[model samples]
Target chain A: MKVIKITAVWCSACLIMNKRWKEIEKDYDVETISYDLDFDEDEVKEYEVGEKLPVFIFLDGDKEIGRLIGEKSLEEIKKYIEELN
Target chain B: MKKLLKYILVFLFFFCFLVNVNAKEKVTLYFFHGDGCPHCAAETTELIKDLEKRDDIKVVKYEVWHNQENSAFLDKVMAVYKTKTGIPYNVIGDTAIVGYNEANKFEIERALEYYKEHNDKYRDVVKLIKEGKEVKINDHYSKQDDKTDKDTTITIPFIGEFNVKNISVGSAAVLIGLVDGFNPCAMWVLLFLITALIGLKNRKRMILLGSIFLLTSGLVYFLIMFSWLNIIISVSTSILFRTLIGLFAIGAGIYNLYAYIKNRNQDDGCDVVDEKKRKTIISRIKKFTREKSLIIAILGIMALAISVNIVELLCSAGLPLVFSELLAINNITGMKAVVYDLIYVIFFMLDDFIVFFIAVKTMDVIGFSTKINKYSHLIGGIIMLLLGILLIFAPGIIMFNF
Candidate 1:
């Protein structure tokens, strides 16, 4: 599965979750695409992200599957990934 | 042997002459002044123009009122001096003269003489400033420095001349208050309260309940600031406490600055209040606006105001705290400090007033544009950073204005 991560420079939650995202990539063998809300606005707009920041979109190929908003703990993120699988 | 002795005596004579020339070199005196200010203008057209004739002093002029770059450079100079922010400020050698007068002119000359007498080579502060080099404040300069910033003195038709401290402190209060009012945390609560009030179709009840709610919020804010003022005053003497507070301001400043950049493309929002707490507040608001009795409704409104203010303080980005600390450090105590805090709260409630008044008049609920909050955060962040740096490094200097 591929995950599209939308983050911003000012979002503390987003910064905190970045290391966890790396760990998740190693554990689940997933490809990740990261986009900054400001610098990558054109690409981020295609996903229609919500008000809150640090969005993670789980995808199969180019088609979207599910997404999560805000800061999720390691266990919760892992569980969500497992559920998606 | 006689011819060799003559050559050595001649060499020593020229060497001493060179060292004396270096010590008494033509010194560059940096004069930063504003155009419209009377004292500075007179100093420029009269004193500076006269000083230009002197061979030993080089007068470098910077008109700060119209020039942005010069104004910024002025701030850099004042920050280095660790002195109060005011114009008509003069810097030469290691000496800085803040306000200008007949007596200060003599003091300037004396400073020139002192630096010429004390060292073999004079330190050109203006050159150091231009080079962006770190200029150290000399202890001898500090001790002999009786020309510290006197603050800008203003003249009135009836009042004659007076210090500009009150005006500066008042302006700071207003500016800080307005920024604090744009706080997203409190704005959300006010919007929610407005929505609940609109549920009451009765105009009289809506106005009464809304006004009381605003009053309670203002009162709570005042008390909070006053408490901080007392606490800061108690610990104001401690260097460690002052430094810590300065560091906290700097930290909060960085957080706000990062927030400004992070939300550049995003909307103004409250990330502090979670979904659970939000739902609870919504339920409480609904219950308050639906109360059967008048007294119970008023009590409910007060309760909502209290709780909302508490939450706002938690996420207010330290505007009120910084303001109270300013008053504490400046030694503005008793009734005078209370008056300043009152002025702050009144302005802090300005947005709420405008929103409520408009909603009551037109029967439409509206809030300030999201852009305003974004800009306020940017400005607030910068001001906090400057104040924090000044507070940490220049504690003894009386801060009149930024």
Candidate 2:
């Protein structure tokens, strides 16, 4: 599974989830592509990130299955990835 | 030659004589106002009357919003006075009064009294700056904030006239408080707790435990908002800070709107807490039920309430921040401010109270429909959007002109 993460520097949730996502990467066999809401505007906008922060979009070879928005614990992140698989 | 010398000496004496302005000399009040601002317009009318009647204080008016010079001068005087932003601002001596109301009028009268009595110490700092002279600020007068005109005054648009009164902010407190009560996080905990409480055979323990939880939640709400109020009041909030909060509001509003749209198919859930935290809360609830010691159970409930509300606070950060910022901008403080926060806390707890009461009487948990919470996000989104825009462009309206 591929994860497209949309985050912003200013969002507290995004900052929080950033650490959790890194930990998730250590356990899960997922390619996580991160894009900043501001600096990487064009790419982030394509995802239609309609507010909230630290968006994690799960993809099955670019066909999006689901997305999670906002801060989540490491276990929750792992649970989502496992469910997706 | 002697007559000529005597004439020159007399002229010199006359010039130096009145230079030392007597105690009765009128105190100059430099008022920086906005032309279309409700508070400024309302204050202007009252100050004009004071100008007409009072011989000891002279009101100098500068229309800042429409005039470049006045606006720039406002910056200069603000630098000297160290007054925080939000207007209908008055610079009286070294003291800066940020808003106008009846409470402020009393403070102004008192300030004028002080300056008049201590005329030798009085300096027209604004005038000195206007004259391109160096000004040294030596005294700090009352740091007290005062109110504007009447208790309920209305103003005609573009007319710059108002008799004024105060009601709108209190109304805002009630309205915002009521709406803000429909928070997902706060509701979620109470829902979870009620199911636990309803299973209890002893109504007294149920009542005691439930009341403790709700009271703790309400206290946390009050303390948090009150602390924000104090921080905003104490910190000299610059335009930059206001702009940042404005941006945050807009961001939060957009997020709320997004939540409203996205949650159409999803269930009402707490996104802020993890499964581990949820389990911990559940375990704690179980302990509260199993504990034979009443004191231990009460303490546990209190701890649970405090912890739950802290997370709830995270989920519902937008309203309290906005509410406190609103209070600061409107210059609503002291006992009036305490009362406002109380109104907010009571209203915030209204839903939780109703839910708890219903659960006790009927021995069943009652929850608000998800639709209500959904629609609230939509409405809340719109209000926050408006407040955010006003906070940036026209803050005086946020001061509640109507």
Best candidate, TM-score: 2
lDDT string, candidate 2, A1-85, tens digits: 8989886533434545777788888887889899976568689878987645568899999799989876555777778777878
Per-residue lDDT tens digits for candidate 1, residues B1-402, read 999999999999999998877756677778987655566776777678888998867889887655667877876776677654455778877777766666677777777677656644568877787798988776245643333224355678897876666787888899999888877677666666776677677788889988999999999999999998878766554446666778888888888899899877663332534647766777787788888888998999899899889876888848888888788656576787899999999999998899889878976576454456678879889878777876777643434431
Mark the 10 consecutive residues where model 1 chain A has the least summed lDDT: A7-16
RMSD of 2: 13.7
The runs of at least 3 residues in candidate 1 whose Cα sits more than 4 Å from the true structure, single-residue gaps closed, are A1-49, A52-85, B1-163, B267-273, B396-398
Residues B234-348, model 2: lDDT tens digits: 5323455667778888898899889888886553322333547656776788788668999999999999888888876888889878888898877566786899899999988
What is the C-alpha local distance difference test score of each model? 0.75, 0.74
Give me the candidate number with maximum lDDT. Answer: 1
Residue B71 of model 1 has an lDDT of: 73
